[model samples]
Target: AANDLLSKAKLDASPDKVTLVIDPLIDGVTGSQSVATHLEEKRVIELVKSSYPRFQVARFSAESVAKSPIVLIGTFTAINNAGAATGPRDAYRICLALADLKTRTIISKGVARALPDGIDPTPVAFFAESPVFAKDASTDAYIKSCQGTKVGDTIDQAYADRIVVASLINDGIEAYDAGHYRDALDVYQAALKTPGGEQLRVLNGIYLANYKLHHTKAAMDAFGKVIDYGLKSDKLAVKFLFKPGSTQFSTDRSVRAPYDAWLEKISERTAAKQGCLEIVGNTSATGLPAINDRLSGLRADYVKDRLEDNEHSLRGRLIATGKGSREMIVGTGKDDASDALDRRVEFKTAKCAI
Candidate 1:
């Protein structure tokens, strides 16, 4: 399947003038880099080198983009009705696009269907650790670039507009993964100064990096901005990991210990608006459905308590609810970091709260 796609993309750019850099493929629905997508990306890159040796594609690097460049961008979509006969495993629809950065046009496109082959859909380190629901305008734009049955006839506007900023964001992610929190903070700061940089990932990256560095003030400010962005979009999901099987936080001193500050910001921001809020708590699908439901409610009430504590005015304006495992983002049910996003507290604006 990879060979079939790469055969169409013109990876053979002039070696001296243009570099062929392959942007990492991402999950179409979630806009996350995953184990499956990473493996597929590796397979496709290898095919570009081994099967089509004549092509001049460079390994991705900061130096590669110094000259004029053409980029390979792609998405792997795992759907419920994958049409593959693998029992419960998901099949994938793969799309690969080649865009010329110099002309801002997608010159070639290819697609293939993937059979269910034990692909791991777990998100990568940075995405799994991120504290907020990631899907937003920027995510929607990127997802748009990867959609459609026929591409390459025109420029992929969403993907094209973001290639440059995406590079900086990737750098920041790498630095964060390597425990260079300060460096990651600086990189995201630099991205914030760029033209197309006010993205969810960029903003969330700033908040996470600051939180890790113990820069409480900066973290709170960035977090407030993240909530503002979410509020504008009308929903916000925050990952507030708790102690096992309980609404209480972990005993670990520093883990999720900033609840007070977090609630202060959440209250400060939400109270400034006219509408009430529905605080919904969700749990991973690890335990019995009944217990999970009750536990999720407890968690939501726990958050509500803290929020109302931070601001007395919110006592009646906020309501607590729970969905348990009914609505899951990851749905993996591993109950670890892999499914952490499943256990989140969401704040949705409400016209009236009872």
Candidate 2:
């Protein structure tokens, strides 16, 4: 894939004076880094250094700002079989490009498709610890920037608008990954005040950082803002894991520990909106369709009951439904943490159900 991408880029035009800096690649769908993306970034860098020295490689840093380097950005998305059915095999498409940091205009871009034979989609440390689905306006902007961006055209306007804070956001993520929660919080809080820095990553980072610092009230407050952002977008999907063959919440600390905090925040945000809500449940591909449908419905009902119990305003405004394995984001059927998103319970605004 690296070779294919290189062949398409314009690095050979002036092998003597081309310099490119490597920006960390991200998963286009989630606008976050992953193990797979890191590996791909390294692979692309090594290939450029060893095979194509015409383009000098550089690191993305403060010291390198004067070099006025072309930044290489990358994104990948999973391509599943057509329709709602799972295909025999799944493929992934990776896109790489070098863009002028100042102009946000693409200089060169290439794409490659390959089978997910051994790719790891597990998110980086910060994202793995995130409790809710973080896809939002920022993520949509990132995805748009990755797909169909022409060589001379600028990237997505929304993403370009927030490009100035990308470096600080990366710093916060790195700090969080290194267990410097306080430092991460400082960076995120500072970024939140920057123009175009109020992206999902900044908001979610603030919540996670405060939560990690044991600032319960502050964490809840920050989390409430995150919830509000998500609810307003109508794309909130909390990860709710269940016990083996049952609708009970998982007893595992990783699963049950922050369950209440998430529920409470969701309840608080939803009640303030005073809108009809639908609690939709889904399962992984490991279970039978018939049985999974019934189980999913039961789980949705359980969440609906919990929400109603949490806030009185949600009593008759909630409805529960299930889709079994019908709508999967990652249809690996592994039924493990890798596919946990498939088993999520989502909250969507709906018309009041009498």
Candidate 3:
């Protein structure tokens, strides 16, 4: 229907130039890549090179795709994490990310069918002659490709987990905003107990709530969980920013432990994996660009020094980097301390590949 409207208005582009972006390929680079990647590397690229190919198809890095004029996205409707039913949250996140690319038009196979409770199914615009692959292999093909079903099931299950986590967070936040501190605590606690509870986020929220309610010890305990869980995952980093130019960590000690624990964990992991560790630094959007950059690097270096000197690692794996305030989790535009969230050090485990 949208295409028809575009054609009637003569606004659609010539079919030959339309391009598509598919899902990220996670299969090992050597494996028969997943359909999404295979189409881009083999089929789409072929079309692009085949003769102006009238219509070009390609798989692009997410960054490139986001900047492309036209893009078609292909995704299998994930049934469940176990690969049973299509997932709602995962699909929405994928679509939302693509929408971020600012493509003039986006067409989905829309196969997963259902959007989560809050997602609206507004149609996106697309250029002429672009076709998005949305259909499942015939039901028979699905059955024959035993692994196909597995793939679908996994997608759905991942979605389910994402939704579960999101929903819990939403409930907690809503309770907090409504001034129901006890209720918010209850919701957060319940979420933490759920099987796929967002351990880190929940702990963070619980700490914040306890802080607000004057439950200092409870807040500290909750903060400890954030530190513990964050330490367990290399990608998770504990960040602490100073107040503007000050060197002190957050006056809130509860806030410091999680980030500190994460750095300590990285030191421990790196010592075990590579006998050494590298710390990267980033800055929030606060100070001058040059100063922030320098400061960020220094902050990372500072963490490395602390870890190298004090951590229990046998090899004392640690390094420092300063990335001044450029990368803010939440923007630094807020009037005060919220900006502090963005200023800090991040410790990452350097993978030592054999």
Best by lDDT: 2
Ranking according to lDDT, highest score first: 2, 1, 3
**Which clashing pairs does model 1 show?**
none
Which regions of candidate 1 deviate over 4 angstroms?
10-18, 59-68, 81-93, 102-105, 110-118, 252-257, 352-354
Reference-based TM-score of each model = 0.85, 0.90, 0.45
Clashing pairs in 2: none
Please estimate how well model 1 matches the true structure, expressed as its whole-model Cα lDDT: 0.76
Worst lDDT 10-window in candidate 2:
80-89
lDDT of 3 by residue, 272-317 (tens): 4545445667665545889877777766666667667555652345
lDDT of 1 by residue, 1-354 (tens): 556555675544555434578777887766788888889878777777787765568855446664548777788875555454322324567888776777666667777777656777788767776767745665675556555534445555766666667888888887887889999999999988988898888888999899888998899999899888887777888888899888887676644547667778889998787558889999977889899999999999999999888888787898899999887776555677656778889988887735
> What do the candidate models score in CA lDDT, each in turn?
0.76, 0.77, 0.43
Reference-based TM-score, model 2 = 0.90
Q: Give candidate 1's root-mean-square deviation (CA, Å).
A: 3.5
Clashes of 2: 0
Off by over 4 Å in 2: 11-19, 54-56, 61-68, 81-89
Error of 2 at 34 (Å): 1.5
Which candidate leads in TM-score?
Answer: 2
User: What ranking emerges by TM-score with the best candidate at the front?
Assistant: 2, 1, 3
